[model samples]
Target: MLRALIYCLAPPPPTVNLVSNKSNVVRGKTVPNGTVSIKINAKVYMGRSDAKGLFNIKITTLAAGTRLYVTVTDKYGYTSKERVVIVVDRIPPAPPTVDSITSKSKVITGKAEANATVIAYVGSQKIGSAKADKYGKYTIKITPKKSGTSIKVVAVDGSGNQSVGKIVKVRP
Candidate 1:
């Protein structure tokens, strides 16, 4: 009597977390002891999954919007499909610089990161928001406030990172 053996053709793809510009390593999960490969900017990095099926690969820090491709190969020489990840910007943009805010003024002018969204707040209430131009200039329209009213402004980058607030006091 003769017996036939069936072999698995490929391993399952690895699961990776969301990567960001602040990340210096790529971490993911695959088959236990499987070989893991990461490709970023056409450069390939190799690593191995631990007994718990978790793997981490150290590589050069990548900028926001960079793309990483990952794959896994099991001990049976079966390779998985490629996984794609995009790095997000985790670093906040610089605080916006605002012009004078007077009691009679209806517009707020500022400079911030190019294409970032600038938001103005009075206490905890949002007043106005605008997107900065290519030159990092923005103007937000808001209702006039009384003298000594404090207006706080912040810049939010494309990746949703928000900077510390810049406070301006409304003058008479």
Candidate 2:
């Protein structure tokens, strides 16, 4: 007699969803179709506009805070207007000039000592806060509800100026 065996295989790879939102808009009245070009990270990905003044493009993979450029061409054969510094990252880039951030024992440190007065935002949602100390230091602690979470931070000065920094990746 002969013996038989059965085996099971893992599932296929998951699909990557492309999420797009209105990055920026150029103001004009007589803007014609094929007059606009949407550039992501300094690369022209989509050109021309539809009847509704809307254009859609898919991005396979993009890091957080990817800067975007939108340009509009005038009927007079000239670059009518251009919008720069538009970011495509779901969460905006965190503020720069962070004195330092330290993580320990599943708890992050350095928000309070940085003199941070407001909570940082990642797409309109506050993730963390850091308040400045007498020595101009701030401390912030971040603990994600789930593992492999990505967050952004922005710091504001007393003069109301904002600075952006890199995205913070949390490891489980």
Runs in model 1 with CA error above 4 Å?
1-8
lDDT of 1 at 29: 93
TM-score of 2: 0.33
Q: Residue 39 error for model 2, in Å?
A: 48
RMSD to true structure for each model, in Å? 3.7, 20.5
TM-score of 1: 0.89
Output the lDDT of residue 49, model 2. Answer: 48
For 41-109, candidate 1 gives per-residue lDDT tens digits of 879999999999999999888999898889999998878889988998899999999999999999999
Best by TM-score: 1
Worst 10 residues of 2 by lDDT: 5-14
lDDT of 2 by residue, 60-131 (tens): 455435554556554454453445543343432235433333333233343431454535444567767766
Top-lDDT candidate index: 1
